[model samples]
Target: MIPSAFDYAAPATVAEALSVLADAGDDVKLLAGGQSLIPVMKLRLADPAMVVDLGRIGELSGVRDDGDALLIGAMTTHHQIATDPLIAEHVPLLAKAAATVADPQVRHRGTFGGALVHADPAGDMPAPVLAADAAFILAGPEGERRVAAADFFQGYFTTAVDDGEILTHIRVPKYTGWGAHYEKFTRVAQQWSIVAVAVMVRVEGGTIAEARIGLTNMASTPLRATAVEQALVGAALTREAIASASAHAAEGTDPASDLNGDAAYRRHLAEVLTKRAVIAAAGL
Candidate 1:
């Protein structure tokens, strides 16, 4: 399949990109990594009249430390995020999750903000962001606004990014002393996860002081397992305690039935993976 003929614009600045988007109105699509939009265009699922390429925007590609949080440029490649020293030191859960996305080549080209804005419930990236309580920075003609990860995702393949807005950066809070893990379940290598769990645990004196759990492909959006988190607090770092807490993994989930597995199977995987992620994150 071929994408419909469309005009293209490559902008060197966020302002220029927003200007282009503004002029193009509702018929334009912004290209970041081209990992999601290009394929959809070729499949004829998306055929915007114009495509604005943000690749030339140098400001939208890097990692910077900002005291309590790290500012990750939207166009930063998964490969870069996966290997960035700052990310590994402050947000290892994201690095671990980014490393597991697709394969080496895809990781080299796919961007972190692109993945999150794509808003695929099954994507591996968003889970870590949710667990870390990250915020998305969106730029538009009206100026910039920060959207929390929990509020950014709206529904299946939907998000807070509007037609004229571009995601410029992701702000991840530093989880300095937390042990984290992203446990993904897939049928084969390079395949999307059927269900995945991201866990970050702060352990104090052999007890779980705080826990954050994020779920992938478990609902219409990347979801925080608040129930599981509440259950894990003050829990002993033992198999029984982990199991009991993980049982609440699917408390408010609405998983879809796909060829990879049915809804019930996904619920079961959620419990299993949540337990594994919690145990691993807690270093039990």
Candidate 2:
């Protein structure tokens, strides 16, 4: 099936794109790489009256280091992020997750911000972004606003982005000297995660000093396994401790029962995958 008839406009600048979105209101959708939106449109799941393409908006497509954080433009492709030296240096967990997103063709066409804003619970980046505690810069007619990654995603396929607002950039904190890992459990090479875990740990003198564990597809939104984090604090890096912490992966999550797996199965996956992610992140 083809998308419904719509007006298309490729804006050369972000301002122009915002203007189009502001004028079109909710009837419009901002098109980034269109890897996610185009397929949804083709299926008639989304039929916006107008598409404000941001592909030509140069300002929304680059990777830069800004002191303590990496400023990634909203339109930066997964392919770019996966291979970017800056991202690899500062946020290897993100690069690892980006490389696992779908296949090469999809990665080439998918944008980081598009995947986040699309807010698919099964997508790889959301958990890592949340684990990294990234912030989003949103631009609209009223100017700009900053939103924390924790607050950016409201639900499955829902976000804090208001009507007419476009996500301009994502600010990821530099993770220097941090040991991070992204562990995903999927049926196939490029399949969406049945349950994925993103772990970032700061080890001090062979003890877990700070740890953040994020769960993907474990709830309506990407969730931080605070229980696991609490369990790991000051704990010796041991299999027993990691397993104890990971056992709480499904403690507070409300996972869906779908074709992928049942709630019980997801809980088990969460526990197993979280342990693996924690072990890898801790270099144990």
Candidate 3:
């Protein structure tokens, strides 16, 4: 398979990239890391008139500490995020999830921002971001604006990033002392998750003080398990309590039936994986 003929622009800076995108009109696509876009284009699923590549934009890569939060540039690869000292120290949930994305080669090439923007319901990255309550920073012809992770993904393969806008950075608050875990289910090595759960727990006085639970492949968008999260709060971090709370993991989900598994099976996986993730996160 080959992509349709399209004009290409490799911009060296964010401003230059924005200028290119603004002039290229609505049919233009921005390329970062090229993991998702290239495949879609080759399959003729997405054939844009122009592609503005952002790989050369140096400012759009790497991570930095910003006060109580960490600002990660959009172009940073999964391998970078998985291995970054700052991410591991401050946001272990993100680091743990990143390490599970595809295989090592894909991890080395896939950008964190690209994966988020691609917004695959089954993608391994979005759950952690949603759990962490991260903010996505988008740059466009007008200027820049921030969209919270909760509001970013609108539906399957859709996001809040509008025409001529590029996601430039992601801001994640630090959760240094919290217990976190990412539990993913896949049919084979390097396959996308059939179902996955991300959990972060803060325990105090032998009870769960706070909890954030995010689900993958359970809806049209990556979902925050608000029901499960609420149920775990103030509950004793015991096996019985965790099992009771985790039963609510699929309470509000709208999972799809596919070859991998039907909606009912996925819903079951959600509960089982949620129990495993929460218990591990609580270290009980």
Candidate 4:
């Protein structure tokens, strides 16, 4: 299956990319790592009139310090995020999640922003990014706009990135010293998660000072385990406490039934995985 013929532009700057997208009207797709779009294009699932490739934009491929947060360029690959020193020290949860995405080749080619924009509920990055409370930066002809992760993912395979806009960077606040873990279940490695949990916990003197939890494949979009997070805060770093909080993992999610498993099964997995993820994150 070959993609339908389309005009292509490899832009050297975000401004140039945006210009290409704008001039191409509403039928253009932006290519980052080409991990997601390329496959769909091959299947003709998405037949755009043009593809504005952002790979040539040098500025959109690195990490930068920004006081309380880090600015991760949209074109940064999953492998880079998983191994970068800044990400490992300041946002270990992101690195943990990135490392679990597919295999070596996919990780080397999949872009963080591309994964987030793809917004697949089964994808590994969104839940962790949401749990981290990250922000997305969108570049458009009108200029740039910032959107929180919670608002960024609107539904399965959909996001706040409007027509003619390109996700430029991710703003991740420092979660330094927090324990982080990504627990995923699949029939095998490198498959889309059947159900996954991403957890970050801040412990103080053996007490859970704070916690952030995110769920994958539990809804149309990656979901924050808010109920579980609230329940864990100020609790003792004990298995019993984690088990109690984990029970709330499926309280507010509407999981879809698919070939992988039924919705009820996913809900069950959510509770089980959340506990395991939280325990691992707490290092207990």
Candidate 5:
């Protein structure tokens, strides 16, 4: 199957890309790495009349440390994030997840922003981004606006990005004292996760001070396991406590049923994986 005929425009500047999108309106799609969009287009799931390619926009492709946060440009490739020394030291959770996304060939061409914007429930990036409490920088004709990771994803394959808006960068807070781990359960080496858990634990004096748990393929959007987080706070950083808290992973989630796993099966995997992730993150 081939994608429908469309007008292709590669803009050298962000302003030009935005102009193309604004003029093309809903009929236009922003092309970043095109790993996700191109497949959908070929399958005839998406039929945009125009594609505003951002590959030529040099400003949207770098990684930098911004004060207390790590700013990753939207166009940065997954392979770049996986191998970056700064990312490995500052946000190992992201680097770990990036390494598990698809295969090396896909990672070579896939963009972080493209994956996040695609908002697939099983995609690996969203869970870690949620656990990191990242923020997205969106640019449009009106200017730039910052959106939290929690609010940026509205539903499956849907985002809070309005028409004509382009996600330019992602700002992830530096979790200096936090121990992070990403545990993914997949059927094959390069397959999407059947269920994945991203855990970030702040341990103070052998006690759990703060915890954030994000679930992938457990709901319409990447869901924060708030119930589990609430249960872990102030608890002793031990395997028993982590197991007990992780039992609540499915307490508030509404996982979908699919070929990989049924809703109940996913709920079970969520609990099991979350426990393992939290224990590992807590060094238990």
Candidate 6:
């Protein structure tokens, strides 16, 4: 299907982009990497009156250190994040998740912020970002405001990014030296995750010092597995301990029944994947 014709604007700066976005009303769409939006547009799932390309905005791409955290520009490609030394060292969970996003070509062009703002419950980025406690920076007509991951995602295919707002940057607190992993299950290659678990743990003296868990495709939005995290803390870093903690993985989830699997199956997968993810993340 051919999408409806639309006017296009390539803005070199955030302020210029915001101006066009503000003026274009509800029929405007922002292009960032074009991995998700382009496909939908091609399918006629989305037909905007105007497209504002943010690709020329140089400030919205790259990784930088911001004291205790890392600042990742919204337009930074998944390929860059997957291989960036800063991300690898401080937030390996994100690197791992980014590397698994729809294979090489898509990874090369998909932007992290674009994925988050798309807010697909099955997306690889959201779970890990939630687990890392990342914050999103939004640029809008009223100026900038930061939104926490917990509040950023409103529902399936929805986010805190309003019509006139653009996500400009992401702040990920350093999880340096932590062992982390993203475990995902799909029906076929490059398929959306039926269920996935993102885990990051700090182990000290053979005990879990801290643990963070995020579940993908477990609800209307990415969910923090707080029960699993709480269970893992102070427990020994062993398969037995992880399995025990993982039993609580589905305690607060609302997985959907679909062709790939039923809700019960996803609940079971969450538990099993949580154990595998925790063990791998703990380097056991």
Per-candidate TM equals 0.98, 0.97, 0.99, 0.98, 0.97, 0.99
TM-score of model 1 relative to the true fold?
Answer: 0.98
lDDT of 2 by residue, 138-199 (tens): 99889999999999999979999999899999999999888888999988888889899999
Candidate 3 C-alpha lDDT tens digits along 16-110: 99889878888999898899999999999999999998999999999999999999999999999999999999999999999999988999999
| Candidate 5 per-residue C-alpha lDDT over 45-132 given as tens digits, one digit per residue, 9 for 90 to 100 | 9999998889998889878999998999999999998998878878888988898899999999999999999999999999999989
Better of 1 and 5 by lDDT: 1
For model 5, the superposed segments whose C-alpha errors exceed 4 Å read none
RMSD of each: 0.8, 1.0, 0.8, 0.8, 1.1, 0.7
Cα RMSD for predicted model 5 = 1.1
Candidate 3, residue 56: Cα displacement in angstroms equals 0.5
What pairs collide in candidate 1?
none
For candidate 1, the 10 contiguous residues with the lowest summed lDDT are 21-30
In model 4, residue pairs whose N, Cα or C atoms come closer than 3 Å (at least 3 residues apart or on different chains), thus clashing, are none
Model 1, 6-43: lDDT tens digits are 99999889999888888887988888899999999999
Whole-model Cα lDDT of every candidate shown, in order: 0.93, 0.91, 0.95, 0.93, 0.91, 0.94
lDDT of 4 by residue, 65-139 (tens): 999999999999999999999999999999999999999999999899899999999999999989999999998
Residue lDDT tens for model 6, 185-283:
998999999999999999999999999999999999999999999999999978998899899999989999988999999999999999999999999
How many residue pairs clash in model 6? Answer: 0
- In model 5, the worst 10-residue window by lDDT is 84-93
Give the clash count for each candidate.
0, 0, 0, 0, 0, 0
